[model samples]
Target: MDNNCLFCRIVAGEIPATVVHETDTTLAFRDIDPKAPVHVLVIPKEHHADVVTLAQNDPAGSADLLAACAVVAETEGLLMEGFRLLFNTGAYAGQEVFHVHAHVLGGEPLGPMLAPR
Candidate 1:
């Protein structure tokens, strides 16, 4: 775990978060800043700078993350209904947080492109 990372702190229980789901490989929590009504972040226990690094360094972790994302979506009532999953890889992609996390967003129809931050 990255000691300086916020998501790592959340995974370690060193920080408090409104957790919606958790498993052996991942943790799902409400986003502090929500874009949608049901915005949540699903992160792996393992520390990864970003999705690219994760996919390169650990294929198992990548698979686990994808599975966890599916689980998070299902648990949040977004599966089958409709939901948007996002993983910002770098600064250009709006990755403010370095930790690898899949953003699960739903509860409303997302019709257009999201504004760049």
Candidate 2:
């Protein structure tokens, strides 16, 4: 775990978070800033700078992260209605936190994945 990473701190119990689901390799928590009615962040316990890093270095953990997202969606009652999973890789993509995580969003129409250019 990266000592300076916020998500790592949350996973290590150093920081407080509203955790919704947890497993041996993953954690699902409510977003502090909710973008949707059912917005949650799913992350791997191990540190990875971004999705690409996680996918290349720890594929199993990456899979666990995705699995956790699905579980979070189901638990948050957004499964059947569907949900969007998003990973922001860098500043241009709006990734404030360096630690890799997926945002599970639903509970209402999400409109579009991107705005008009």
Candidate 3:
């Protein structure tokens, strides 16, 4: 775990988060700044800068994250209406935290994936 990483701190129990689900390899927590009715962040316990890094470095952990996201979506009652699982890679994508995380969003109409430009 990167000592300076925010998500790593959360995984390390140095920070507090409203955790919804946890497995041996992953964790699902509620987002402090909720963009939707159901906004949870699912992350691997292991540290990786971003999804690309995670996938390249730890394939099993990447699968664990996806499994955790599915469980979070189901637990949050987003299965029927569907949901979005997003990974904001870098600054251009507005990834404030460097650690890889999957944002599970649903519980209402989320409109489009992006604004019309």
Candidate 4:
């Protein structure tokens, strides 16, 4: 784990986060800044720079993260209405943290996936 990475610190219990769900390989927590009523961040326990990297290096880990998404959606009561799973891969995608995370957004009408440009 990168000692300086924020999510890594959270995984290590060095930084505090409002955790919602956890598995042997993943953790789900509430996003501090919520875009939707139910905004949760799902991450792998093991550090990976991005989802692309995680998929390349650890397929099982990637699967675990995907599995956590369904759990998060169900727990957050977003399954009935549906939800969005987003991964900001790099800076251009507005990825503030280097650690890979899937943003599970729902709990209300979220509108279009992207702003009209």
Query: What does candidate 3's lDDT look like per residue over 43-99, in tens digits?
Result: 999889999999999999999999999999998999999999999999999999999
- Give the residue spans of candidate 1 off by over 4 A: 114-117
Q: What tens digits encode model 2's per-residue C-alpha lDDT throughout 19-63?
A: 999999988889999999988999989889999999999988888
Q: Looking at model 2, which ten-residue stretch has the lowest summed lDDT?
A: 66-75
Superposition error at 80 for model 3 (Å) = 0.5
Ranking by lDDT: 4, 3, 2, 1
lDDT of 1 by residue, 48-97 (tens): 99998999999998898888888888877887779999999899999998
How many steric clashes does model 4 contain?
Answer: 0
Give the root-mean-square deviation of each candidate in angstroms. 2.2, 0.8, 0.7, 0.8
**Residue 16 of model 3: what lDDT?**
96
Worst 10 residues of 1 by lDDT: 108-117
Number of clashing pairs per prediction, in order = 0, 0, 0, 0
Listed in order, each prediction's TM-score against the native is: 0.92, 0.96, 0.97, 0.97
* CA-lDDT, candidates in order: 0.89, 0.91, 0.95, 0.95
Model 4 lDDT per residue over 1-117, tens place: 899899999999998999999999999999999999999999999999999999999999999999999999999999999999999999998999999999999988888977889
lDDT of 1: 0.89
TM-score of structure candidate 1: 0.92
TM-score leaderboard ranking: 3, 4, 2, 1
